[model samples]
Target: MSKALDANNRRWSTLVWGSIPVVLLAGALTVDHIPGTDVRLTVPYAAEGPGPTFDTLGEVDGEPVVDIQGADTEDTGGHLNMTTVSVRTNMTLGQALGRWIATDDTIVPVEQILPPDLGEDEVREFNQQAFVASEASATVAAMHYLDRPTTVVVHDVVEGAASAGILHPADRITAIAGKEVSTPSEVQDAVRAKTPGESIEITVERDNEPHHETVELGENPHEAGQAMLGILMTSEPAGGVTVNYNLNDIGGPSAGMMFSLAVIDKLTPGALTGGTFVAGTGTIDDDGEVGPIGGITHKIRGAEEAGAELFLAPAGNCDAVKRVHTDHMTVAKVDNLPEAVAAMEDFAAGRDVPTC
Candidate 1:
């Protein structure tokens, strides 16, 4: 019995000692470093951490975060903050290892944040464009929720299609077939109301003036027999209500929800945040629907650190939020603009806000 016990102990010791080298080798490979060498590899990983938070309801550098021009905006008090995630890419092996062990940041593949083929400049430009588009959608969604006027603007015109020369981008479609149209669906429904080769008159606002054009409809590129105008249109705020997002540093569609909330609060009577700190992120469409965004965990940490009372997350991201721990703030799931507003009001009223 004593010999058997000694043999078992020896085998266990050998196994434990053997795993140490294999574990070190795996760790070295994970950090892209060679064992017992000075050589370091360029790791295709990025470290993401909590970034700075900006209040959408306040001004940044003497400029309002949500600048609404040509309107008598109401007084807004409180904070509707937007959060961001800072990413460090193209890390050296030693730096990667340091970040992996020293910080609470997430280390992920660089391709998750940026493309390998495109440079940082190109990625920044693309993200800025997406941010601009999200701002437009946020403005339109706020206006729609407030029952304000919206016009359908031509986004693009396809070549070799009917109305290609007549309709141009940036032209706002005011009416179609002698009927008023304000949304993209309205325009499409009116066009499809007619058959192919049918001529219809369209009224467009171009360069601050109305222009009339009569063009025959063409068959839908995707549908077999449906009629199409061959132009893509999007609904936007009309009547000189211009919304300018002030942040030039932050890029991406994640700020859409906060932008929409700020617009609503500014155009309405009372404060939406009730003078308390509230931070959230999601991509909002023109219909007030909220979509999920990346980097929710880091954003949560930032918001909690900023002393936010409530954090609004997309409904789809509730599962992700559940994995993290928030000590000070409450997390509420929002599927649209109304839900976000309700969450804020409930928190302000000392009601029980929904948790992740």
Candidate 2:
């Protein structure tokens, strides 16, 4: 009788512990069966929770995750972990119900992740591509942040296009609207943010001298009504300084910030964390601008699981992060790479860490 009462008490304790997430997940639960007779019904929702993290400053499979060549590398210590979210999709009803009461992970419509229009493999491919692109951007971003020589030059300006004579071929594009740009995609993304006929200031270096042009955007030849600069730009990293990322099966651009931090740590003299464990997530650009990412809470939990002392969150996710309750980790809001580095420095020096 006592054993049975203890079991009942434990069950109720768990239910109370996870009651909030249970209530949250109950609404999104829907049937999306895969025609399997083994299970009663499969839920269409996907669960996203903490996934395995990697220390970018450390080794993976006996190789440094961030391998920098032709430069003096720092002998770094502690963790500069990049967090990931473990996703559970196409779950059976039994699994879904168990998860609701067992974990604090979030469940959402599967279509939000794996859209109906694309297959899982295709989506994975796109994610991997984004990861590669972000890695390239992070490499140059770190270089640019360190004031190393990097260039984003106009390969060609399309004839009769918006930037026809406004942007000359071989012109080294410096910044877009005062924001430093070191990649062609940043230039493209900046232009795409505006509509046709919108004017933008494009700073460039022609004949090794500073210049700026205010050019009116033109409609994209491919996507109607969208803005285009009509100038093809190419990025070149600092010569002989190559960065190679050596982790696999991890997809998405969310690791961009951590990767940049790793690169910066490696090239610089002192470790950013100063032997302190740190974990963070943000999509960073070649301009060192940090952007928000999904699964913030999940990544936070992952960082905590790895015993991280500090959590570096993007300023854009301040509202969301402020809602979370953490036990011991110090959460700091960083707007860009410089801010992130400063946060780490502050934490290392035993200073009062900033929070959202």
Candidate 3:
């Protein structure tokens, strides 16, 4: 009985000692090195310059469409394959700490760099609401011919906005509080340092006339920050040239040209919406120049699948857009908004409009 018990004890001890290496091997194989299993990869839109790599922020099962309608006043120069995206998700505390250390060493500090090209005060004073307003009112005339000569800027100051109580966009900020505000940082700093719920006077220039507004201060959402006034202000122009256009297609912002053309057509004597679903994607500047936007092929695929009778392709992206287009999909290349609208209107008159 003693000999049998001794043999059983030896077998149990061996089994306990043998499992450590097997567990370690499994962990190593299934750990950080596994592709798709452990780590995921993504392509980001960024300038082709040296910068920190970014991660995905969010994803839409199907892409959202936008209207690229507006005056093409400023020239974006040319389109590039870069993109900017917000990042989401954080790793473990230990991994995050390591990443933070690396970023501190590698990234350029915002404080050390110069302010935006449009200037500091101009940046801080930009209004989101006004931009939407300007987008709605901006329209084109046929004889306008997309005035692409020079860029002009105008800012909109909605009459009922928070800023409307004190100022407008085209009203260049000459000073803030008691200090002369020149840059965006100074304007932001002045506003930020003020006590919550206090009112401060702002000086602005409108049509060469100077005016002052005593704005009631509000709470700043940031930690320990002063009171805030909810307002959007920008140095961007509210109206300008009508350079490029696509006719009669107000599908998405990508179809800005089409929307603009439709606006022009409706505003004018003739009709532009060819009465069919017109789909497209691109940036329409104030000069009416067509600029390339990301995810064109994906957008085209979406439009085609949606059974769009006509697709307006950004002139520069014709080659890429054409590659995926079929006989069922008629890709009409347009330079700007007016042109797109025209194409859509024409296409509709030819084909029976698809029922809702």
- Report the C-alpha lDDT of model 1 over 308-338, residue by residue, as the tens digit: 9899999989888999898888999999999
Which candidate number has the best lDDT? 1
Scored by CA lDDT, what does every candidate get?
A: 0.90, 0.87, 0.46
Per-candidate TM vs. native?
0.86, 0.72, 0.37
Candidate 1 least-lDDT 10 residues = 26-35
1 or 3: which has the higher TM-score? 1
Q: Taking the tens digit of each residue's C-alpha lDDT, what string does model 3 give over 30-113?
A: 343444575532211111111211101111233212123443222211111111112222233333334456642222223322
Give a tens-digit lDDT track for model 2, residues 331-354. 999989999999999999999877
**Predicted structure 2: clash tally:** 0
